[model samples]
Target: MIQAAAAILKKEITQELRTKYALNTILAFTGATLLLILFTLRAHQMDPTPKSGLVWIIILFASMTGMTRSFVQEAEKKTWAFLQLHANATEVYLGKLIYNFLFLLLLHVFTFFFYLIMMDMAIQSHLYFMSAIIFGAASLASVTTLTSAMIAQADRKGALFSVLCIPLVVPLLLILTRVTRFALIEGAASGALNDLAALVGYCGVTITAGILLFDYIWND
Candidate 1:
């Protein structure tokens, strides 16, 4: 199963390199949105509280632009059927989950870095802020990966994906906002200890459930 997962992961990477569809879409959306926010809202001059919220909002929406591609692309490209046939459900899910996590983790950091540069926000706890980003990314990735699988076969994938995903990630977004506040406003890692724990717990639950349920979802 592990070997199969690795092969799937490698396939994903190679396919992404060949196509660059997801990466390009994410970059375009993220850059354009950041530019709009910087010019229109003057995010750099916004209040600290709102700035933290803005960070997550941008990251989440920007991710939504391309995160669904992992599965949707497979289905569209007619590779999903191949995956379903050659790989067992668990292997496919794990492989997809890993790719999603890695892509999302990088996307979070990229969006955060651009936001910091554009906002000129000072950070006292780089470690804590980065930790929060990691946890937040993982949690969101886990949930979206599962939801993407659920909607991969649907016709109106964009609308249906958003409907299924937004409510599920609300708790994650709230926790992320709290942690960001602590990192950017309170400037204390201690202030966000509980939120960080919550993020970890959420990630564990979602990933575990995803692994357990993928076989059923895939086969169904």
Candidate 2:
């Protein structure tokens, strides 16, 4: 299982490196969004509440822009059939899950770095903030990965993807925004721990559910 998943991961990384399609799109979208925020509010002293909200908002929208590409590309390129034929349910699901998780994790971190610096906001606790980054990526990846697979089976993947995703992700964005508030304003304050725990639980539940449902999705 591990090896198969690793092979899938390696295949994905290789494809991404070769074409740099997803990476380029994600980078450009993320960078432009960050720059827009920087320019719009660079002068004002933005409070941590809205600042944190904006942080997750940017990540959320930017993530939406690129998250569907994994499965979408496979369909468009007609490699999805080959992938389905070659990989088992678990291998395909796990491989794609890891790829999305890692890809978004790095993107989250990069956004965090530039966002903090560009906004000239001081992070009260790097660890707390990073906790948000890791779990935020995981939560978004978990949802997007599974949704991508489900939508990949449909004709109107683009519209269906957003409809299915936005509802599921709203709660997650709320939790992340709350934690960001705590991280930036109060350090690792007591209240933030609950939100972090919520994130962990959200990841666990989504990933587990994705694994169970994916067999049917992949084989369909």
TM-scores across all candidates? 0.95, 0.94
lDDT for residue 78 in candidate 1, whole number 0-100: 87
lDDT of residue 206 for candidate 2: 88
Q: What is the lDDT of candidate 2?
A: 0.85
lDDT of 1 by residue, 154-207 (tens): 999998888988998889889888888888878775547778788889989999
lDDT of 2 at 158: 79
Shift of residue 174 alpha carbon in model 2, Å:
0.5
Q: What C-alpha lDDT do the candidate models reach, one value each?
A: 0.86, 0.85
Q: What's the distance in Å from true for residue 74, model 2?
A: 2.0
For candidate 1, the lDDT comes to: 0.86
